[model samples]
Target: MKRKLGAEDLFKINSVSNPQISPNGEEAVFIRTEIDEKDNKYYAHLFHIQLATGTISQWTYGKERISSPNWSPDGQSVAFLSNRDEKNQLYIINKNGGEAKKVTTLDSGVNSFLWDPSNGKIWISSKIKSGKTFTDKVEKEDKPLPKAYVVDGMKYKMDGIDGAGLVPQDSYSQIAVLNLNDESIDQFTTGEYQHSLQAISPDGKKLVVGVNRADNLDYVFKSPLLLIDVETKEETTIVDQNGYYGGAAFSFDGKYIAYAGSDHSYKNATHGNIYIYDVEGKTTVSLTDGIDSPVGDYAVADTQQGISSPAVVWTAANELYFQLSTMGDVRLYYATLDGAIYPASPEGEHIYDYAVTKDGKFALIAVSNPTFPGELFNYEIAAGERKQLTHFNEEFLKEVELVQPSDISYEVSDGNTVYGWLMKPAGFEEGKKYPLIVEIHGGPHTMYANSFFHELQLLAAKGYGVLYVNPRGSHGYSQAFVDAVRGDYGGGDYTDIMAGLDYAISQNDWIDTERLGVTGGSYGGFMTNWIVGHTNRFKAAVTQRSISNWISFFGVSDIGYYFTDWQIGADMQDPEKLWNHSPLKYAKNIETPLLILHSEKDFRCPIEQAEQLYITLKSMNKQVEFVRFPDNNHNLSRTGTPNLRIERLNQIVQWFEKYI
Candidate 1:
């Protein structure tokens, strides 16, 4: 008997990511992650599959988290990052199987690493403190005293999985090379600025990385692609244009480097395009010129754990393969040096990550659709045949009754069509009118695609219709549409969303309009707050990690300083404009029963935004409540504490059940 998908099912699901094809292409290694219900933590282990026999085996096992699995040049061993010890360190294990050996013992551990194709040494990027060496030992004191954090620059903090909160002023990310044969570590790059490791040249003579060395790092958004000589320690600016460039890879012969970036033409809403730079000619050409969509996966979902977007890969044939966001779907694309582009994989599914062979004959892809959580698929590039390689979520799928969303296309007041997905409630009947819940996604720039979203499924299972759409500010659409929300936060974008809801209600009479509810996070959360303040149509609303005021946000959020000017077109210089656009300013007009969910340590939107809204409404004797998850960041819905994620979902369902 199939049961409705429960929030606790998160513990039962297995997530597979970071697939790396072996040099011989006979086997592939990937990270299989699972939640330990006993510890309320996520543990990942390396798993490999013999492509010829389709035999799967667990290569590494532990309770700790492991990530970034890569095949050695000779394919005799596999190297990955794991926190089995204190901090995340690099570890290596033989392909034939044995005890895993710890590689780097760096003080700060490894951020990311790559195998040098020529020298067979591991090149890694790790954080280094001002006065400490790579292998320095921490001296224990009799007692520790509390110290104050002296803030300096505007770019002082960042939001992420590891070291998420405040950044140390004296710390910087540096690059080094480790030789496993002699255990000798060569510290190569040292600087106050951070250097992100992109890739080592095929010949291993040079490395390409992204770094911003501007005088004012806070003001400049450009991280030019830099080519650093391995021996000479000299740097050459490969790309110094006014754009943000990353995910770089060198060609087979090391004659060209392919990367993805945007020129800030639309600020953060700009579309990312793939560009190839000639090593000798020092010229760059945009291969994806006419394609309006971004160069990577912008499909928004909550189920894929440890998933990363693939960089532009260079094949032995000199052609490039990359992912593209198109019409609410992420697809693999093939591009030629002469500027021709075509689809390499099928559409209707989100391809989160993929690895292609050097010969471009086969690809290992991690994809998900409306009903499927995610799984690895072995795709024959030439024949377009796809075979499932991993059955991580097979049992979970069999036990749950998941609802598939239907495609929706409707025209707004401006006559522009909007794309979205509508999921009928689980055990839905034709004559029964079900309450409708409007689900909005974050990144206002990210699209709500045809992907498996656990949150939406949970709502559908609870007998509520789920409606999600990529409004004006969403990707996978035209550049003009994506850039439409900038400088007009609650203006056209809000209308587009309201129009989508109106259109959805009109198209489906089974949707109970009187019991409408709204919920979203980040920018979506901002919109949810805006919706309640502007209209009383929604009977209940839940806002998560939302921004209610742009004035305080400019100083509180990690990206608030520039994001305010870029997205809202206002800054501290214009207080009136910021206040006028703030949802808190219109709090008095809100009548919907609101539930505010926020992470206490969310640096993106910050909890203060929610506090202000809660205080304002509560003081007015309005129906409002607040729930704060301690020690969690802005990513609570996607990758927060396992138990708390379940609690958060239950809160949402209970809130709707009580109010609607």
Candidate 2:
């Protein structure tokens, strides 16, 4: 008999990502990640598959994490980043098989790398210290003395760094080239700015990188694409507008560059568009001009691990292929230089990651659905055929009975249609009412799509109906709809969510309205706090890594200073306005028994947000509990330590079971 999905099922789930097609289009390689329950660690290795025979084999092994696998230009070797050594460094292994060879010995390790198409060299981006070289070595000491961090800029701290959320402000990411022939390395650009290497020209003479050299880097959010000459180090700003840009790729012919970004017209809620730039004509055209959906996958889920969305892929025919998030689905799309765009793959499933061949005939894609975790597939672009390539999660899936979420589309009070999904309780029986949990996604900018969500599945397994919706401030919708929540906070967006719950209850009579529970993290967490404070309808509520006071958030969060100005339309200068939209201001009105979950080092929302709420509720003799996770950042729910992730799920389910 099949059993419900337990918290420990996390150990059995295998996630596949970053599929890279061979240069000759005959084979493909991808990264398969599994959790080592004995060690409480994640182990990833490279797996290879033949396209014609559908045979798969493991190409690499060990306990360390591996990522960013790519085929060399000659297709004779595969290069990837691994933590087999202390830091994540570059490693290359022959295709025929053998032990992988370490390629880069940089002290700081490699951040990203690209294969030089014209020669035996690799362009990489690595961190360089203020006064030290990339190859410099430091003497080991038995007991090192403690050092103090000097007071510096506001961008000194970030989430998921060293578990304490502190980063060295003096270190900067710089570009370098490594010659595989002699194992010699050459440092290129050096500056205080962080450089993200994007793509290299077909001829290997020019490299495109994204950087922001603004004087006040904290306030400016622009990442302009700079075309730099490989030898001369001369830079030409190809996209210097007031916008955010990345994922740039040079066309096969080296005459055009395609990139994805937005003008930030709606601040963080702006939809991303694909633009093609003419290298010779110095002109740019938007390939997805009227496309309302955002480019790249915005489907929020925890089942996928180490997945990198494909940038714009250039075909030999001068066309481009990319992924876009539409109404609750991420689809592969094909575009032409003349500005025509259409779906390259069928709808109804989430295409988390993909790689297309140079000839544009085949694609290796990672697909997931409401009932499936994820797997790799070989897709024939022209014939619209998809063949399963890997069954990594087949055994685990067979032991658990998963529920498929039904589609939900309801009109809100503003005459706008909201999209979402509703999952019935696992092993649900008819004529029986069950408690319903309203799940909210973070990123008030990301959408809840047709993807497998482990948390929601666990909730359903525990006999709770789950309702998740993409409210007004969600991607995969119109720009106007997504930007509607800016400066409105608990206004229309709140109304839309409540209306969705009412609609779900109205359509399904088996929902127990009195036993309602609500939970969310980040922006969703803020909304959950707002919900409990505004209405006592929900019997139980759990808020995770949430914001309570916008005033304090303006100074504490890594993006708080500017994010407040962009999302809340207020800052420290306007304390009253900031407080008016803060959930902390309405703390006295909360009546639901609340459980606050937060990561101690979550710089995004900070544990202090949860502290204030817990303290305020405790002072009033209200039922409230706070759980603090140490040495983890804001991503505790998704990419935290495997043990902590399971414990988090247990906390949420136990809390709802006790109150609701």
Highest-lDDT candidate = 2
Query: Could you tell me the lDDT of residue 391 within candidate 1?
Result: 94
lDDT of 2 at 22: 91
Model 1 lDDT tens row, 1-660: 799998999898888889999989899999888999999999998998999888999988788888898889898999999998868999999999898899888777899999988535899999988766676666767898967878778987877534457877688888888888886788777668788999889889999987877767878878888998888878888888777888999998999999999997888889999989899898888888899888888888888888765678878989889999999889999988988899998879989889999899899999899999899999998899989989989999999999989999998888889989899999999999999999988998999887888899999999999999888999998899999889999998898889889889989999999999999999999999999999999989999999999999999999999999999898999989999989999999999999999998898898899999999999999999999998899899999999999999999999999999
Task: Report per-prediction Cα RMSD to one decimal.
Answer: 1.3, 1.2
Error of 1 at 249 (Å): 0.8
Show the colliding residue pairs in model 2: none
lDDT of 2 by residue, 537-645 (tens): 9999999999999999988898888899999898888999999999999999999999999998899898888998899999999899999998889999888988999
Instruction: Give the runs in model 2 whose Cα sits over 4 Å from its true position.
Output: none
